[model samples]
Target: MTALPRNVPSSTDPHHLPGVRWLRSSYSTGANNCVETTRPAAGPWAGLLAVRDSKDPAGPALLFSPESWSGFTAAFH
Candidate 1:
């Protein structure tokens, strides 16, 4: 697996990321099959972005650097 960024939180339970405001893209469809993202406002995870499947709020979250996430999303734009 690819290595995650320093200070990034990796958890099997989304609840591990407390105080995060998970939000789906405005372009998401009503089907609710989109992913959600949140940048931790405080704690050790602050500054890193957390992402999880909207359909599975209690599932694992993948962490990424803001730059990394920008690069990934830029590919589709």
Candidate 2:
């Protein structure tokens, strides 16, 4: 079987993902307490979505597959 690449960032350091464009939801309040997501356009992490806490842009991020992210949002809807 082929081994899967490590999609998640090694740490909560935003610097680890330099150049990634993190985007927060339009519904986010001005409080700056929301989660942001970005897709790695290139590299081993490409195709995976990265999510991080808006309060801590330099913090670690959690990676998810497109299908998983869709199911997650669907559950809330």
Candidate 3:
């Protein structure tokens, strides 16, 4: 059986994602306390939107499907 590599990082944590680009809302101040969003381009997490706390980059991230994320924001909009 194939085994996962020790050096390979997992998706639960944003810091583990390689070269991921996180986006922050422009309305948020420069305090870096807001959450960040990024779309993972590959891996098992690919096609899912990843959200994480900017304050704690090493913290766990929340994954949401495209439809779910849209509905979530629509409520606020």
Worst 10 residues of 2 by lDDT: 1-10
How high is the CA lDDT of each candidate model? Answer: 0.72, 0.71, 0.67
Residue 32, model 1: Cα distance from true site in angstroms: 1.6
Q: Give me the displacement of residue 19 in model 1, in angstroms.
A: 1.0
On lDDT, the stronger of 2 and 3 is: 2
Model 3 spans with C-alpha error above 4 angstroms: 1-16
Per-residue alpha-carbon lDDT of model 2 for 4-73, expressed as tens digits?
2234553435446646878897878979878888887766677887888788776677777787788777
- The full ranking of all candidates by lDDT, starting with the best, is 1, 2, 3
What's model 2's lDDT at 15? 48
Clashes counted in candidate 2 amount to 2
Reference-based lDDT, residue 8, model 3: 27
For this target, which candidate reaches the highest TM-score against the unseen true structure? 2
Candidate 1: deviation at residue 67, Å?
A: 0.4
Candidate 1 residue runs with Cα over 4 Å from true position: 1-15
Where is model 3 poorest over a 10-residue stretch in terms of lDDT? 1-10
Structural similarity to truth (TM-score) of each candidate: 0.76, 0.77, 0.74
